[model samples]
Target chain A: MSGKEALLEVDGLKKHFKVNQGWIASLMESFGSGEPDYVHAVDGVSFELREGETLGLAGESGCGKTTTGMSLVKLHEPTAGDIIYDDQRLSEATDAEIKKFRQNAQMIFQDPFESLNPRMTVYDTVAEPLRIHDIPNETARVQRALEFAELLPAEHYFDQYPHELSGGQRQRVAIARALVLDPDFIVADEPVSMLDVSLRAGVLSLLDRMTDEFGLSVVYISHDLSLLRHMCDRLAIMYMGKIVEKGPTDQIIENPQHPYTQALINAVPVPDPGVGRDRVELQGEVGDVIDIPTGCRFKNRCSEYIGDVCDQVVPPLEQKTEFEQDVACHLYESAAGYDPYEEMSGSPSAAETGDGAESTPADD
Target chain B: MSQLEVEDLEVYYETEEGPAQAVDGVSFELEEGENLGIVGESGCGKTTLAKAIIGILPDAGYINNGSINFKGDDLTEMSGPERRRLKWEEISMIAQSAMNSLDPVYTIREQIVEAIETHRPGTGRVESDEIVTEMFELVGLDPERADDYPHQFSGGMRQRAMIAMALALEPSLMLADEPTTALDVIMQDQILKRMGSIQEEINSSMLVITHDVSVVAETCDRVIVMYAGKIAEEGPVEEIFNRPYHPYTIGLKRAFPNIRKSSQDLLSIAGYPPELVDPPQGCRFAARCPMATDKCREEEPEAHYENGLRSYCHYADEIDTELRPYADDSDTWSQTAAATDGGVEE
Candidate 1:
């Protein structure tokens, strides 16, 4: 994927919401001319989504994967930086231009039960997007979308309300609504996490097929790395609203270059009973995002953190492999000397790689 | 004799439509110091079975048939007072969702103290406090935090509090129903390891009911795969993982995401679980099973034993070769659907 093939580009985005102060505090602050405290939900994150390719954004809860997705679709205005869609800067675009952009970009929310209107029927639910986009031949479009979502013979399901449908069927309706416009890009924010184990696979496969069929780019946000490896072509691991590591799915999974990424991989439980790998347990809980650590956000929990360098300054995402893989860790920086990719050639086999892939030094 | 035996257990909910048979004719036994994992999807009656075993099913639900024998005493036949006496003394349970299970108004100490006094009367406050402190330390929680309310603790710590409460009496068997479902990966790992170590320490058996096969694989010694109120397969953890007999077990194993092999895609079982109200004839898993045959649909498969593993599939012998290599598929939709619906079914 090149820039021309990219459907969405989010560059150095930030979203900070001002915390409301008490009345007296507000009055004091107004008189003092002091800056109000802001919740740093998203801070200086960047990524690109290639047309028809699924890019998974993975992190622990409260790490801002959801906020990043919301920011991309303009649900929350960017505090700074630019969002470029199809070569057009979304921040500078006119209302008409933004409306046109909305037709091509849509979102599939985490909770289908909450997202769908209780009062509306399945037919109306799927048709709402088409109506907003002012799509012609509304009924036909709704039926077509339903068919695409694998909810066959739309007539049987059209008049049925959301509560009437099963969890899987309701999710299908949600997907249909998202896809009815034939959008070029989608932000699937934990779409299948709320569903049961059996239903999760059905919804996941549907998303996989729809991506290929509709030529839609997707930014799949989830905490599950194992699920991401199955669906995404590439993935970007986030920590405290920063892209800690980004690469091809195979490379990231087989050769994780960041300590946070390594911890996540190790933390995931393997299904095989015969195979057992030593899990690297991180100390304490995820630190508060309000007052983030100065250097690497993960330095406190990192197993390979050396010393003062990790505490003194932040690490920049440096190219660790030749194949577009980047990681922001101090250990990767010291041994490999900035970009580790220059010394290595072609991608190694998944079997050849091990946990050492993430042990590299960070770039300042 | 087994420490706990559940025979022909049938629990039903009184719905407007009809009686919903949640755990129809489910039978299993747990030996002393053994961990038996009951694995299934949502609404497959794993939780209901757990609740039934502990005599804590909802008011609307009732045991329509079958008996629960704990330490050779018929739990189903026991009187209310008799059951109360036996409740947390011999058998205890760690309920699902510790966040909701713990009372919001009370401190962790108060709740544990109430449970201890209710079960084992005449025990003084000093003795109860000593036991509570020991349990808190056993589950890796600081003893000082016992003063804090449920809301004050994180989800994992609350779960530890629940476990400590359940283990206050040091019961012979523990029934944990999806105890780690709502917890994050790191928390889940700690909670599971604690439960395993605690089981060993107390020399007690446990029945861990969960939907995640990976959790069962890591924590359990023996695994039982259930489908729509019936046992599909039961075997040693290694045997089931390495060589699954039933098609449902195979599908489930493939569906679970493994951290060791990151390249493989999760294999979703193709169809929905059969409605338990009027479950399908023969094997309940036949509708979604890849290896479903005429015989499979007409007559339920009898449990067959081979190489120390037991499976409830008519063609378990023939399906072993087909079931292997399923976990490695990067895209399961095409590969899994292709394998079973092709040669074997014909």
Candidate 2:
């Protein structure tokens, strides 16, 4: 419930890593190879982040949630599409404009141990950002950031390395570094997942405070749904390099539209033993991003597989509920004329058993 | 006699400063065909306990004093070879990291067959092959991939292969130490479900050690909540989740957000767990616990029993009246911890 102004507008964002490389690929290219392969890590994902609104990217491992977050912060240059941030196109921005954007946006990595340099002291880690941005009063700024991160008596930690600090303290240092520049937004990828449960809440609450105090828009990328539900205002479920569902956090959690989203929600183990949840056992693992399915990426594992429509036509993400929820499933139609579901009783064995058999339709 | 009984187990890891009392004076019993979970945070010694039971402690670690009685046989008293003989035949372990646990050089089939042949000498190759195939099918893995090396398999598949190997012998006791920690949530759920069915099929008791409370709640019939290398609470899963008596348990339960409940504040237990090396003489959790007092810091607490529940706390009797209410509030812990700090200063 923040301002209507879109702080970041991402349209058709795509990042593909070349699978065919090295001497072999060069030789093939010399002979005029037919086509090179690519792993579609973040393929055609689009979302708008309203100012000060926290958006969560939820999915299993290799679902491109991390890739999407990395792409947004320009950690991975996009192969296609546009990233409009604060009315400035990042892909086409000049050197000065790009530097300004870099100062305004920050990213907190998943592993505090790996992300923070072991050799760098806590003081230098926080001050390095300010120094890079050419901001003055580095010591004072770093001190304020550390204090804001709840590392009291900041001067005491200036000399200490990451190894000297506990997992919680290391994460606090990372948060301090991320917020040292006082960025407009932060892309925190599994920030607290590495910390202990006791320490997790402290770091999370600190994040909550940052958002409230600074009105910082945060993009939280995590597989833990419960954590996301607690921290995020909106939820986007990614499956096979695409957003399968996007909606308000509560609405998506309570009433998931996409079958993949439903499976993900059901799979999260509830802490309360009394609530006996009916387990939605989705068959098969997440599809390979390299050889993505032609139509619905989730058709291989979806328990509610309809028919040939899922095998031939890719489902467009559209408004399928009364609330502001968009789901990419043939089960929900954007128009009234065509019904995607012809039969639901037959087993999806044809879809399951065959790989790259796009020619054979399950049903017309 | 129980299927397995650990009495006064004390495992210490040698460090430069002193011996870290990783698992100090811990005792628990597992009945035949029962699922028992040991839940705690990192460095609380849950992993150490599991490692000690399996007789796979590192060279630096040793059992100071304890008895591990399996089927009325003392494993702790047994020699290294004697304990090695019991491995895979009596008590098998599913280690935390599948990638690390699985042998990368050998094929999956070869490794499993080697395990079978080692434990059951004179076992024919054809029979071992059948066993590997059956185990693979049982764990929802393709039998054709048996020849594939561990490096070729995905994380989930590798874990399943581990389960297949662990259950190949059909050991009476199965010790899974954080089996699903490295996998995705959906993959974790699938693996847990598969483990459940396989356990039922084989009729083996499982000892799941994990820091995830929700995973424990789902898979365990009974749970032991460990803190600073001691059991803070032990009871039926329902009792632990619904009505915990120990302040640490209450704090732990509150730390995890209930997916079913709409937006609620998560209360992190203030302060870290006490240093295991030369730990304080009083209650180990007194510093972080909300109901901690001067007595808690001065004297150790004995086990207080209520029905089938066992809580290690000074104010266990007055949990409902005193501890439970304050444990949920974030401010209560901070205030109590601050007051305790002041008292320490005084």
Q: Can you write out model 1's per-residue Cα lDDT over A191-225, one digit (the tens) per residue?
A: 98888786587689889887777777889999887
Worst lDDT window (10 residues) for model 2 chain A? A355-364
Predicted model with the maximum lDDT: 2
Residue pairs of candidate 2 with colliding backbone atoms: none
First chain TM-score for all predictions: 0.88, 0.90
Off by over 4 Å in 2: A20-22, A321-323, A335-364, B336-346
Give lDDT tens digits, candidate 2, residues A1-364: 4585789999878788867578977787879975666788877888998888899999999889998998888888887778999788898899999889888889999898899999899999999988888999998999999889878768888999888888878888999999999898999999989889977887898889888889999999999999999999999999888899998999999998898898899889989877878788889887788776766888888888877778756676777634469888888756433343332223344433322222221110
Q: By summed lDDT, which 10 consecutive residues of candidate 1 chain A come out lowest?
A: A355-364
Q: Pick the TM-score winner.
A: 2
Task: List residue ranges in candidate 1 displaced over 4 A.
Answer: A1-4, A20-36, A320-324, A334-364, B262-266, B320-346
CA lDDT of every candidate: 0.80, 0.86
